[model samples]
Target: MDWDFLIDIFQQLLGGVPLTLQLSLLALVAGFILAVVIASAASSRYRLFRWIASAHIEIFRGTPLLVQVFLIYYGLGQIPGLRQSVLWPFLREPYWCAILALALNTSAYTAEIIRGAIQAVPASEIEAGRACGMSGLLLRRRVTWPIASIEQGQQGRCNSAVP
Candidate 1:
């Protein structure tokens, strides 16, 4: 084995750590927000919102991240109106494209995880919260969200090998 050559390549790769960390953190934050929105939509009473959220999750989850990146970075420019829009400047950049792809992909997975976690919360606990005068957003914020967060944490640890 070429130990010296391997070490040299590893050292070179280390130079990209800062950019990698930045992209990851950016994606994590954006994806979390997107996931929350999508999950909420999935759980909404409105059929349109549920359908749209389901479509977003299915489309992203079914496709490859590389294809998504290519589509956003190269294909978006091929569209007529988008190029003339205010977002064209940011969308044209590869860094933004990559971040968008990562955020989108992460959001799809995170949305499902969150949805499942929310569903897994016990009905008894929800009833208890209701008895305490918690309902709507307050019920979710005080009772449901914390349980779901814990569930997500455990699942995250178990599925750490994924991605």
Candidate 2:
């Protein structure tokens, strides 16, 4: 109801924009790296690799992110081994803890995006690669991976823009 109050609040909120921007950009970069690892693991011929990747994605995605942040910060501090470790100095700071949680949260969603995109690539294209004597690294590099890369980039941009 009060225009002056709204403007004052907005101006105050503007001061935090730098921290918000840093967090978002850092999460995006870290999530992109995690997505690549998840995609590779999901596509691997080894069953164990696939299982590990899927489990990691599901566990992170299923939990509430705020709790994850708390757990990483407070929970880690409670552990004697972790508290005494060299990593404790970094993890003891709440800023790094928040960033870690944000990165993991974004990574889980990105993993799903990459998995779906890779699956959307046509099996026929893979067969064609074999027909053309393109197998292993050559086939994946030239055909399968390129198509999936395009889909990942397109979907990632679209999804990140929405929120």
Candidate 3:
């Protein structure tokens, strides 16, 4: 019966679409980049790197997004010297604060996704790549990464949907 009122509400929601998309794209791109580094460290031979990466994944993933958002948006403002820092301008903006929070939160989940994808590649395949003289970055680029990335793409698409 209240078609006009419903239309007005829908129009109001539509006005936020641009900002929502902008926030999502920026956060996703940033989160993916961070995820790669984190996943690499998580897979590293070195214990310290592994520990750091594990801790990061746990802490970020374990905490609630709302708590993280509150910490970044409100907590950042409480830092004394932050006002004088070069990051002050960006940190002070609500948009940037939201982006940072989203990026950090998403990066943890993305890291886990990437780690699983990389692990899903068979060990024999890695050995074969080594046998073929594919080493280090080259092996990763041609073999492990190519295979794993397929999984990553699929999983990422699924994971990106909001709950």
Candidate 4:
């Protein structure tokens, strides 16, 4: 084996690290943001929100990632006016298409994790918070999520886990 040949191959692979990191980091951030919205909708009191969130999760999780990648990367151009729209520039790029596909794909799984965490919170804790006159966002912020977040931890349960 030639040492110089192996080094050249390593150099070529290392050169792509920045682009790979950019793609993965951007996809994870975008996916998490979308996942939070989807989870909230899934846990909502309204039926319409739940339905939409469920559909999004089901469709994205049920379908193949390759199929989604192909659809977003290639199908968008098929739309009559999309090619002429402002988003066309970004949509036409392979990097953006891959990121979008990855984000949507990850969002479905992340949303389910978030939803499961929320559901894992005990009803007694929620009742305790409500008894303290906490409700709505305040209840969720100060009480619900903290307990839920720490529920799976080995430390048992904590009212405020992180902060």
Q: Once all C-alphas are superposed, what RMSD does model 4 give against the true structure?
A: 4.9
- Candidate 1 vs candidate 2: the TM-score winner is 1
RMSD in Å for all candidates: 4.6, 5.2, 5.2, 4.9
User: lDDT tens string, model 1, 1-163?
Assistant: 9999999999999999999999999998999999999999999999999999999999999999999999999999999899999999999999999999999999999999999999988899999999999999999999999998897778746655676
Off by over 4 Å in 3: 151-163
Superposed by TM-score, candidate 3 places the C-alpha of residue 23 at a distance from the truth, in angstroms, of 0.5
Q: Report the number of clashing residue pairs per model.
A: 0, 0, 0, 0
Global lDDT scores for all candidate models: 0.95, 0.87, 0.94, 0.93
Model 2 accuracy (lDDT, Cα): 0.87
Clashing pairs in 1: none
Q: Which stretches of candidate 2 lie over 4 Å from their true place?
A: 1-4, 149-163
Give the poorly placed runs of model 4, Cα more than 4 Å off: 152-163
Worst lDDT 10-window in candidate 1: 154-163
How displaced is residue 50 in candidate 1, in Å? 0.7
Query: For candidate 2, lDDT tens digit of each residue in 137-157?
Result: 898899987998887667646
TM-scores, one per candidate? 0.88, 0.84, 0.88, 0.88
Consecutive 10-residue window with the lowest summed lDDT within model 2 = 154-163
